[model samples]
Target: MPTHYEGSKKERIALDSFIKFMRASESVTSKLAHGLADYNLTMSQFGTLEVLYHLGPMCQKAIGEKLLKSGGNITMVVNNLEDRGLVSRKRRESDRRFVSVALTEEGTALIEEVLPHHVELIVEMFGVLSDDEQQRMGEFCKRIGLAAASEEES
Candidate 1:
């Protein structure tokens, strides 16, 4: 079964493009999630580890901001990672109220092992697009994201 929409030409174009964009995002995310499964990681877990790996120690609030996750959600993710001994949280000396999360040695090793293959997978996924096309697509996405963010702010 297919969805059928009756609209003006511009409206139809916008609807079709939005549908395709959503489908593409889902497809890519699903593939990546499957790829992460062998490591016993969810997408959020991997994202949290990756951020800690690259950014060093950060407070939970800052991590949530970087990952665009809610405070409670970030706390849960950090708790899970900490349970696995992949991440550790320490109270800030200057601010005992804040806890900073950092990758453990084990976490660093795990992400280092996984990141290269993940990059390869990403490259392969986008291989169908020429370099220039990829660049143009990135630019277009940035513009759209910025506009959406601005609208949210307004």
Candidate 2:
């Protein structure tokens, strides 16, 4: 059955494109989340680990910014990782009030084991797209993200 939308042609077209974009994002993320489940990690936890793995220690606030997560959400993720002995927070010598979170040896080892497989999964998921199509898609996403960020700042 064809779904009918009540809107001007341009508005309906824009809405249809937005819906497709969001559904594509959700579908990709759902697949990736299933892949991470074998390691008992949520997407947020994996994202945090990936950032700390590549970028070294960062404060909770910094991690939140990098993940585009709220402070409370990041705190919860960090606490869970800490409980699992995958991460540790150390107070700064110069500013004891500020604590930086870093991956533990266990965390480093875990990410090392999982990252390659994770990358392979991503590659497999995007294999339907030609290299040029993937590149163009990336460029479009970046442009959209930049515009959204600028709107947020205004």
Candidate 3:
């Protein structure tokens, strides 16, 4: 649903656009999260695993940056994965402050199993758009995201 506020034209247009964008984002996230439930993983946990699986071992700070998650949230997610024996963290002898996160054998096996389904779901969701349209949409999203980031920094 669009905004019902009786505001200026620019405000009305921006509000409606924001509403649609959020709804679509929520819809996609919800769909993806539903599948995570089957694996007994939260969205954050799955994201952590996926990033570790793809990006290899890295510090928690790097993982947080990649996931756009907070340090505390990343810590919790890593802790949960650790409890499940899906990942491990090791501190370098030289610099104990630098702990690297990596997928264990079980984690590797699980993500290998899950990634295909995840990709399929993503393809299905975006399949509504043609290749060109999807490309254009990605560009638009990135541009908007950059603009928003700059706005936030100002």
Candidate 4:
């Protein structure tokens, strides 16, 4: 009996490459979370602040949607950021039922300073790959993610 290496070589190579990519992503994200401690920001808090900084003021519900998090989860994140004086929630003028979230001056400054380092960290970790390789990897990952997501719809 012989070992059945039956799949196309290309498929095997792609699967191996994807496994390595996922491992690297997990490792890098863990390191990034640890690194954020210097700025006193947890991963979730940093993510929330980054979203607010980029999107400007938005309703609390909107932030939850963008983050792919539940309203309760967003509320906890917002509460933490608020405790740090990094974000503020204001009632929408048109409808008292809605509340808008905006980063405070402190939050803006914090994210501004941290973002460059975050980018640099990502680059330093993965910049070993050539531009073409990176592009190919991106396309591969995007296709995989889209395929997986589409399966849920079907």
Best-fitting candidate, scored by lDDT:
2
Displacement of the residue 122 alpha carbon in candidate 3, Å: 0.8
lDDT of 3 at 107: 99
**Deviation from truth (RMSD, Å), model 3:** 1.5
Give the distance in Å from residue 110's predicted Cα in candidate 1 to where it truly belongs. Answer: 0.6
The TM-score that candidate 1 achieves is: 0.95
Candidate 3: give the clashing pairs: none
Model 1 agreement with the true structure over 1-154: per-residue lDDT tens digits: 1237888888888788888888999999998898899798888889999999998999988889999999999889999999999999998899898888999999999999888878888999888899999999999899989998999988
Runs off by more than 4 Å, candidate 2:
1-3
Per-model TM values vs. the true structure: 0.95, 0.92, 0.93, 0.85
Worst 10 residues of 2 by lDDT: 1-10
Candidate 1, residue 144: lDDT: 84
lDDT of each: 0.90, 0.93, 0.92, 0.86
Please identify which of the two predictions, 1 or 4, would achieve the higher lDDT against the true structure: 1
Clashes of 4: 0
Compared with the true structure, what per-residue lDDT tens digits does model 4 show for residues 1-154?
A: 1133456888777677667767888999898997788898888888899989988989778888887899998899999999999999999899988888899999999999999988888898778999899898889889989998999999
